[model samples]
Target: CSSTRKVPSTEGKVAFNFIQINDVYEIAPLEGGKTGGMARVAYISKKLKSENPNSFLVMAGDFLSPSVYNSLKVEGQRVRGKQMVEAMNAAGTDIAIFGNHEFDIAENELQQRINEASFTWVSSNAFHKKGNSQQAFAKTDRPVSEPLPPYFFRDIKSVDGMQVRVGFFGIVLPFNKANYVIYTDPLETAERLYNTIKDSCDLVVAITHQSMEDDIRLAERLPNLALIMGGHEHDMRKQLVGNVWILKAHANARTVFITNVVYDRGSKKIEVMPKLLEVSEKIPSDSLTQVVVDKWNRISSENFASIGFDASAIVLEKGEPLDGRESEVRSRSTNLTRLVVKAMEWAAPEADLAIVNSGSIRVDDILTAPVTQYDFLRTLPFGGGLVEVEMKGALLRRILTSGEENRGIGGFLQYSEKISGNRDKGWDINGLPIQDSVSYRVVLTDFLLTGGEANLNYLTETNPLIT
Candidate 1:
């Protein structure tokens, strides 16, 4: 707010800056307090708003679930995403799109969060399945068409009073879930919305939470879109496809993308320049917003403390950064998963091996030095007691083979050090071939015992001994 962002003096040109982030889970700084606090983001917002006469703060998706803070009990109930909306409101967010995780919780809870937000919200193909007419859920102020308005528009005038139209639309991954909501074809919906506004708007921008492949396909199909601010993947990426530019930042508010749009009135030309901002100590905290963040942080810490876990205290000095990112851990080996499977083994020391679903490991971040109680909770937010079972070698082989078949899924197995396998090929235990007729003891979560996986349902059916 104090100083203006210096820009080259380009005559007959005016600028607009777009500030964007996605997949934020933590309200406070992560990595042992080294990166990503909402107060810093709030400060940057104020600075960006002052620097550019026209600007927008946007989030693509996945702010509603898979969080350690959500695991905290507030008044003896799940505080799922109540903290996120409060912090985003303090940060002064302008708009947001619905990500797949938004549907992870109950439908009523999501509607409650929507009503709680102070910013405008938009969506693509997100509609209520019932009510006879397939009513759209997102209540937009400026209604465009059926199934909820697909886009929002605003206009700004240059120094000479020439009006410029800026239009925005949003689309997300087509994660189909029955009964409550529906996700129509993403590319088709985006194309239709762009066609409707292309005639009137000078620049059309998109807010999306889809794969880069879909982003590229959408850009190629609709060449009129100026930029696609994307999410879903934690990796930061920037690419130009046809006439459209695509951008994404790291997840958990660790990174952000700021796009400066310069429009020249004389040449009727537009140029887009994007910069990646790493949320670090360089950005000062806005004390007003920091107050709200601290309130939630303090409450969360105390909640964890009551359960014999000091959320902020150091637990272990990690030798290397444990890769627990969603995309990576769900598909491959990670120290966090290994540590978790080992813990399961400790509880059932008599078992031959320990195994659990990758989806069960939801902390979704790298564990650096001085790992804290919060870090462990983040890794296993949905806490449950471990269970042990006895099964024939044939059943064990079948269970592992099924897990390998569904590779890269959250439910994929992450087993203990004693067990190894390629889901598609075969499995081995303790450096020896499994005897078909012999029975082996194994440890796993009760969820798995109660039919969490397709083949795993047999565990409960047989009613094996709970060691």
Candidate 2:
């Protein structure tokens, strides 16, 4: 085994590999089994580890929630990311961090998943809320609950006998404000943790679940750092901010970023090379990990059967791919988004128009034909029902403006064919300008009525302008 290899000195230099995937939700291959499978990722990680003993598989977060399996109940208890933890364990995942969606499940369920994980978790800014006090989230598998560490470090020796200490710290975006979570300032937490561990380790890395802007700010704040593996964005991206490299892979294990690092001990210089690899049918699945994935697939099917739906039943078959990719749906209206809005309008025939937030559509893949009931479940895992609201045009216009400004983010709205117009030109419904005195009947997701959407908190049903 590569782990048993002897180390030989190579004139004060060390090399290692980091295989990173972020914002993964599904364990099976998506898009007609052509792309994305945790088992395929496992094959890549295992292959890399066989080539280099210092290889580490890192998940940058968002694996637990917003998945079809997460909504399923098995044996009277919610699956709640149990399948993901089991697959990751079998895949040999080494390290991970928390994403905003990790808090989507109940606090107890989140703790249970943490306890089930075999990998190390590092979180620098997030904490468990204990009344007024804050504490690290803990694993309860042991007799005593062990708080997860703020940072993680590992000592690695190259085949040339050059020893290096690598350190990692993780910070999540404070987007999801779960009652049990307390989030500190990510920048402050990162700087403090880096200062604390930098001296002890030759290299330090960050695993973050935040916006690209936030990641850039972090890179600028700590220009000496070598790399930042990020999540929350469903697209793959890489940017060099000063000497540091920021990398993110496509969501749902559709792709992975492999970062190769070489450090010169004498000169204290680090070199990073990042490669984005597609996880497709071309790559073979790891047998052991596939077994775990298949088990979960069976559970998911069984749950669907119990709930009176055929998991494998075809919902629709389209020749062209439905564009539900995150970047596309959040920024502009796509066919899939239009279809969803039309469905809402059909469900509420009396409503003047229908609107849905881009975030409501979670499957970030361009789904191909033969879309199954399972695909629909994955697309809208949260499964909120449509709600009709009566609100004055003045309030409706304000809500539309808020959604317009939220472009590129989840809060952006997808409107039915009846609505059109832009900020400068003004919004219109069915070719007529919105009149402030008119009361419009609008259909939207029930979640939005609670004023939970970004920058639209005043849109609740209790507002004077809404009924």
> How far is 57's C-alpha from truth in model 2 (Å)?
0.7
Per-residue lDDT tens digits for candidate 2, residues 258-348, read 9999888899899899999999999999999999999999988988998898999988866777888898999999888887888888899
Report the poorest 10 consecutive residues by lDDT, candidate 1. 1-10
The sequence of per-residue lDDT tens digits that candidate 1 reaches over residues 1-467 is: 01123333347776788889998878877766678888888888878887665677888898878788777888886778988888889888888888877777776777667777887778866766665567667533235432335687767665555666778888888663635787788988998888888887777889999878899998899876779999877678799987678999888878889998877767767788999999987778888779888998888899988888898788887588877887787677788778888788888889999878886776667888778878888888656778777788877887777677656655678887877766454677888776657888988887688674544556564554332
Q: In lDDT terms, how accurate is model 2?
A: 0.89
Index of the highest-lDDT prediction: 2
Q: Rate the local accuracy (lDDT) of all candidates.
A: 0.77, 0.89
**Model 1, global lDDT:** 0.77
Q: What is the lDDT of residue 38 in candidate 1?
A: 81
Clashes of 1: 3
lDDT for 343 (candidate 2): 84
